[model samples]
Target chain A: MSVTLINLFAVPNGKEDEFVKLWEAIKVDITKQPGFISGKFHKSLKPDSRFNFINVAVWENEEIYWKAFEKSAAPMKEKLHQMGVEMTPALFNVLFEY
Target chain B: MSVTLINLFAVPNGKEDEFVKLWEAIKVDITKQPGFISGKFHKSLKPDSRFNFINVAVWENEEIYWKAFEKSAAPMKEKLHQMGVEMTPALFNVLFEY
Candidate 1:
């Protein structure tokens, strides 16, 4: 079954623009990987919130999602880490839709 | 501007089926309300995890989303509360797509 990935991100204050630039590059590379269905990046409506960014994506399954992340997105992920962006990812199976 | 809403849910053990049923009713009513863009219910891949469900949705904005939820989904929300489902919601604006 396909899995949904929700990644929560915390970026340093006043670094939104820089973070978005890095994410643009990472998003381009990651979406090209096998089993990547669709995805989007979101910024919190509440500007002062600590966890201010979220990345939502759908992949064919958990394995392919991780494979793509490790193979194509690891460097960018590292770049994000170096920039002090904290990320927490959770995966789920879609139960229902309408 | 459009807003994305991610509602994290923690359902008790072995109550997946019951939770899904309540969510089905909720999804139906909520989607019919004005400003309700779209949504999906997701169940965690790991059954043993503490947080086992998530509701991802898009709305026209924060105001309309709350209006819709209050007008149409409050009762169901209460039912979920009575069933011991814990919910945490975060709102966001779409930052980018690829």
Candidate 2:
């Protein structure tokens, strides 16, 4: 089954550009994952700066998704911290199918 | 092709519950549309209140997706307007697929 993972979190507002640079660096590894079907990153646009980014990644299955997250997120996380992100990720499962 | 639609907008802060009620009411019509695949809504957890919602809705194609939006979004939009939402919907096209 296809599953969507909504990863919500904040990176320091001023470091948005730097955060993308770090994220792009991990693309090579992230793409090589077994279940990495797709992903898209969205920033809270103008007049709204509370939440930083809502990243939705679609995967083949939960098992494969976790493997990718375990390997890829930690290092990128370290870099995000160095860039001054202030919060942990908030996770949500996708549940709409018609 | 599967496309994820990221709908971002602001709704009055204290009326989150009312928003859900309006959303759920139209979900029935929403589910009956062709190409409707999935949808998920997320909110800022804490210490962040600028952006109201990050809603991710997936579709089989752009055609069906737009039609569904036209048929279903208008009325729910009005209810939302009556509730004091002060922004236009910000649309993002999904560009990730492996």
Candidate 3:
């Protein structure tokens, strides 16, 4: 079963461009890791939400997700934190699709 | 430009199956609407998360998303509420994909 990893972040005002550039680099680097299927980055349409950016990634399975997370996510998360972006991450098992 | 709608639900411990069934019906019904591209339902891999169920749908764009949401989502949300499922929804604009 493919698993999903959703990372939601809050970017400080006026730092959207810089944050996206950092994310772009992370995304490119992580694609080289095993089990990375696809990834999509999204920005909130609502202006008021504090945590407005979301990165949705699909992996081969739970184990693979953890492997990639440890190798790629750990460092990327640290970098984001250093840049002052806070992230909330959650993992999921896809049940049904239509 | 495609838009994504993510609905995160918190279902009572024993009602996951019932919630999925209701979601199945809603999914089938909503696919008949315009601008409904695709939908995926997922369950939390982490056992302790409060909001475990997620429905992710891709739409043509913001306007079309609103149209489908008003037609399908409004009623389905009401039904889910009646069934005691609490949902949090967010809309997003695709920024980058890889």
Best-fitting candidate, scored by DockQ: 3
Q: Clashing residue pairs, candidate 3?
A: none
lDDT of 2 at B17: 81
Using DockQ as the yardstick, the better of models 1 and 2 is 1
Residue-level lDDT tens digits of model 1 in A23-86: 8888878878999999889998886765789888989988999898788766777888888888
Instruction: List per-prediction Cα lDDT, in the order shown.
Output: 0.83, 0.64, 0.83
List DockQ, one per candidate, in order: 0.73, 0.21, 0.84
DockQ for candidate 1, C-alpha atoms = 0.73
lDDT of 3 by residue, B1-98 (tens): 88888777888878888898888888888899898899889888875676688788998888988877777777787788777888878898889889
User: Distance (Å) between predicted and true CA of B57, model 2?
Assistant: 4.4
TM-score of candidate 3 chain A against the true chain A: 0.89
> Which residue pairs overlap in candidate 1's backbone?
none
Off by over 4 Å in 2: A87-91, B1-22, B28-54, B57-98
Better of 1 and 3 by DockQ: 3
Give TM-scores for every candidate, taking all chains together and pairing residue i with residue i.
Answer: 0.86, 0.56, 0.90
